[model samples]
Target: MSEKTILVWFRNDLRIHDNEILLEAARKADKILPVYCFDPYYFKIAADGTPKTGALRARFLLESVADLRKNLQALGGELIIRIGNPAEVLPQLAEQYTVNEVYHHREVAYEETAISEEVETALWNLRLNLKHFIGHTLYHKEDLPFPIKDIPDSFAIFKKKVERDSNVRPCIGTPESIITPVITDAGELPTLTQLGLDEPVDDPRTRIKFKGGETEGLLRLEEYFANNNQIAPTKGRNGATVDRSSKLSPWLALGCISMRQVYWAVVKHEQANNVHNTGMLELELLWRDYFRFMFKKHGKQYFAADEQTENTSAEKQTLFEKWKTGNTGIPFIDASMHKLNATGYISNFSRQMVAGYLVRDLEVDWKKGAAYFEEKLIDYSPASNWGNWAFVAGLGHDPRDNKYFNLAKQASELDTNSEFISTWLPVEVAV
Candidate 1:
């Protein structure tokens, strides 16, 4: 909190603007040292034996990190890249620079919080402090009307209470320029294959060009509101077409853009134009915040399936394989699944449909489906991805527990011409 040196560790909150940790470190320090760790654990196998991260996500991450590094450099600071656990790396960096405190955005999930505790312990042993700031959510937890545990059981209740009781704080605390510290090595950025992943394949069927980083994120946001003139994706559980939807998740998941930034942007758009769905976009952000709060309140239990879950069995495995490959015989579900497989992206509407089909229709375990999405989605946020899959499978806080999607009815309503289905699944098959 003084004019001493501070170490700012970059995690998911990659951007410098609206980054409380970076702003505080810059304002209080004579020098700032920023670093990002490509955790080996992330690139390793997942709990379900699936690759923890695939080529698409790994590539997007690299692009995001590179953009962060360039942004920091432009501000006169350099991003020190490393490949290791943050628990080991941060402590060493603190010792190397004699940092007064380590600053970073807080991560609410069990595994991330565990790492935070470990790093805090390691820093305490070195006589340094590990300080965390709120950068992920639109409203900091302290600003919420109720405590995380007291969060409303349903999103409607939660959103209503939050809208009435809470305020979205304006983002305006960043330093104009970062003061650079003397350093010999800035470190190297790793390629996808260098990070133990295969190269990504280009699919001509994919729609949105999902480039990562804050620049792209902000530009895409501007385009969505101004040039694209797109509104709400849809009101139901069907895959949204790319031409009119906002493709902001890929950058958001990487922390290239803050939620508050997006929220305020929508506010401005609504004031300037008569966009009917501006509030709907903010509703999506609220849902994201809900999942994060749920993780905070329930911890690991938020992921435990409440229904009968078949995690491992021959029949389940076969069903999971068929589902993953997008050959489950159901044309609508298959189309959505194929869309997900071919591109590391899918609309929220289709996501629910496919997730529900895997759990209720095919009778496969929800964890398997969730794990596969974790591996595949380019915009995969642990809080959003796992929480949503759980919600679909009736494992999370769903008022309508054990809800099932009528796939045929959903496709008929959303994909009236069967455009989305035929585009993803061209071959006709008997169902």
Candidate 2:
């Protein structure tokens, strides 16, 4: 019998290191083919007719895929690119290659779950086995103490339980070697112009500066930790630069980098430098895991405005619009929205504040706000985006509804000199 070929379908998990699916495929198969699909459906307009993946996100995705292609090639594997529905395209590829099995990282979001199901069904028809590995979160889904059905209703309870008991598994390294296959024919990657997006022009004013890819992501992790010593800050008022934060979210969001790799790097940094802190960085990573666990428990309902109950009100819609267009009449909230719209990025603090303004003060549907973030944010992840929105809307794990920031209070606190607000919202506020 000829060597069995296993197809490793790259979705959100783009990096080679710490990728369980890729490593498992290499271990089990004589030959492995790496594949990535640029689903046109992602770029389609929603019912509201807005572009689903806006320019910033599309551009970042393009960069990430390009980087992944390079990384895979270095590992003696070709990154196959396809444009279409994966359910249709993947099965066809499997049939062509006589693939015995397909492996991929599991995704828990509604659309992702739907696609995974569809693709699995299609592959089953061809007698090819489908294998999925948990890789997006720091904590693997299967290792959790409680099953999906038993996931806690409150985040604090969930976090405390996991931190005390759950172990974050070590990172999975790449295979020592794999036989390079002969399949070289692959489709072209979509250009910004092809995707109906203008080339991204660099902005001189923006503070956040980086591009997509695992290499850049790793490099950033090194620089931020080494140069900044951000972990030393005890309070939020330490005057640390924005880069003090991990800056790994964008890469992690796209799966160009794995959370396991990030966790290990932070551990190594602390060990080497003898630096210690209140585990703020670890807490942030836990937040990421918490979102994934929440999605696992709630499924599609997590995307809904009321996962626990159904109580839609008219006032929520009104507030959602104000939040979307950055015209909420609150200077700080408006500035954060404008920054997100322009650059596809925002600080974590700003994200919470703006989300709160829409869900609590403006009384808008959380779905609309989450969808808008999905369209605009370069670092958008279905779990984090929807989970945070639900928290703000008082529909997720939060014990109580949080209040939106008072514009003057936040402006004075976060942007003491009004620098961040003025930079994004250059126009003077109306009296």
Candidate 3:
């Protein structure tokens, strides 16, 4: 019998390390063909009237795809690139390449899940197997202590149960070399214009300068923790430079590196250096895992808003425009929005505050704010992003008092020297 050919569809899990789908495919197939699609659906204008995949993220994605191709090539394989719907392009590739099987890391978010479902059905119709693996979360779904539906709605409960019950799986091995598959063009990485995005302009004030891909992500992990001795602070929620940031989320967002790889890296650091504060960072990862499970448990309901939240800011368009532009007249919320627009990211505290401002202060629907962030954040994850917004909107995992911060108090503490605010403030705000 001739050698079996397998097609590995690259989605969020872009890295070669601890990649269950990639490793499993390498073990079975004679030739492994890796492919990534710059899906048009993701780039289209969002409900908030901005491209869901904006320039910063589009550029980061482009960089990541380029890096992924380079990494795969270094391992003696080529990453086939495509532009279009995965549901269509992936199946066409399976037919064109005579693929015996298709393997991919599964996604839990509704839109992502829907796309994967369609691709699975399409591949099945072609008489090829579409295999899905769990790589997005820290813990594999099968290994979870409880069924996804039975996952506790409250994060505190879920976190305690998981920490006691589950183990963080070790990184999987990468194949040194794989048999070559005959595919036509490797396909060019599309330019920003091709994706209907402008070239991203550099901004000096932004906290995140993260490049995409596993190499950069791992390098960042080391530099942030080991070199800088930068453990995550107790999230002071005061937007000081160090108080507010770590650029890890962007890499995690892209699946450029798996949560397991990141978790292990921290473990190695703590063991080598005898650090204790790494616990908080590890907890953050657990929360990332919790959101994924939440997405799995609730599906579309996770994105819904509670009916009680209202639009206090007159018209929907008027209030949203101010919120989006960071002209909300609340200096703290405005500053956070300004940083987000300029840098494509904000610290977790800022995310909570701004999201709360939109819901509680402006009385705008939390979904509107969530939709806006989805279009903008360099590290946007549907589960975490929507889950967080809903949590603030009193619609997610916890049913606590709706979170709201004193804008003046936060501004006073976060920008005491007037340095951050004055530096990044727009001309209008500054004047």
Candidate 4:
């Protein structure tokens, strides 16, 4: 009899730790062919006239894929690397390996789902199955109290219901050994130039230089919660506005670490330290789940601008260019943009401040700002990025139609000493 071969297609979920697809594939298949495809589609130009993946993000992704390959290799498996549409590449792989099924984690975004469908169709034509698993969210979709369509439109209400009715499922353990048939060539990782992009110069001023891979991600996670294993609100030096986040977003965004792994770590820390500081981190994870579910529910509507924001006037366009380039003339807004442009990262508060400034103060199209973010943010995930932007624009699940931030008031409270402002902005641009 032919060996039962299952092809595990790696997407956003890159790590082997606590990954459902890997666990299931290992359990069911006689041999597993791990694959990572650098789809040229993701490297193409977006509607915003920027490459869909920027240099920094592309660098992060390459590192992540390389790390996955290393980990799989350590486990006696090879991560098959290919560059093309998954529909075409996967079908060819299925035939070449005589694979019985293709397994992957399902994505919620329109384009991702479309690609899944295309791959599914292609696999169907070859008389093979494309099995999908849900492993991204902290809470499994099946465990939710309400159905996806019936989830409350208000985040507060949704949060309350989920916190009351649902529990985060325990993580699946990593496989001890993965079995794969030997293959001569698994393909090679691509360079930035090969992806039609220039290498980004490292900016020394950024607070944290994030390296991709599960090893680095797990190390950072431990370092963040090292103090008494307590996850509490952090403060910056001299109480200046700094990103006090765990810095796990880039890894989390790419699925280097599973949400459940992070959640369980927080729970363990909370239990060990006998502290209640798990609320902040858990709440953030819940918000991430909410955004992903919202994308699943609303589909493409999250990308739409409201009637009031339909304008493409030159003045608004000019303001958008300035806002994105860190020349908004408003000190706080400019500083935020500068930080984002320089490092491809910013604090959640800074993101809110800048998004509010763009939508409320500058009155530019929220979609444009979101598109620029899609191009720039190294940690950009479809649901979180677009969902937060929509929330700030008052177009997402919230009680308020529009939320406004007082720029002067925010700067006064967060950057009272202007230290953050000085760090990112030029002397002339500094207030």
Each candidate structure's count of clashing pairs: 2, 2, 2, 0
Q: How accurate locally, in lDDT, is each candidate?
A: 0.80, 0.77, 0.80, 0.83
Give the clashing residue pairs of candidate 1, or none: 238-350, 239-350
Off by over 4 Å in 1: 1-3, 46-49, 232-243, 274-276, 304-311, 399-409, 416-431
lDDT of 1 by residue, 248-345 (tens): 88888888988999988988887777555676577678888988998888898885656574568788788888888877877767777777776788
Tens-place lDDT per residue, model 4, 1-431, is: 77899999999999989998998999999999999988998899976578988888888899999999999999988999988999999999899989999999999999899999999999999999999899889989999999999988777788889999999889898998999977768999988899999877765566678888888899988987895433455555556644456778899999999898898998888788787765767777877898899899989875454656378888888888888887766777777777777778887777888888898888887888888888788899989888888888877656273222223444445663433454354333323
Best by TM-score: 4
TM-score of each: 0.91, 0.89, 0.91, 0.93
| TM-score between candidate 1 and the true structure | 0.91
lDDT, residue 430, candidate 4 = 25
lDDT of 3 by residue, 1-431 (tens): 98888999998888888888888888999889899998999989754467888898888888898998988888888999999999899888887888899998888888998998899888888888888788888888887899988998777777788889988888999888756587678899999999999887766665457788888987887777754436655433354544524468999998988888888887887788786667767877987998899888888877554656555455877988888887766776777787788778887878887887788877788888888898789899988888888887777657473322233344455643323444354333332
Off by over 4 Å in 4: 228-231, 234-241, 303-305, 399-409, 416-431
RMSD of 2: 4.5
After superposition, the stretches of candidate 2 with alpha carbons farther than 4 Å from their true spots are: 233-243, 303-322, 401-411, 416-431
Q: Between prediction 1 and prediction 2, which has the larger lDDT?
A: 1
Q: Residue 356 of candidate 4: its Cα lDDT?
A: 83
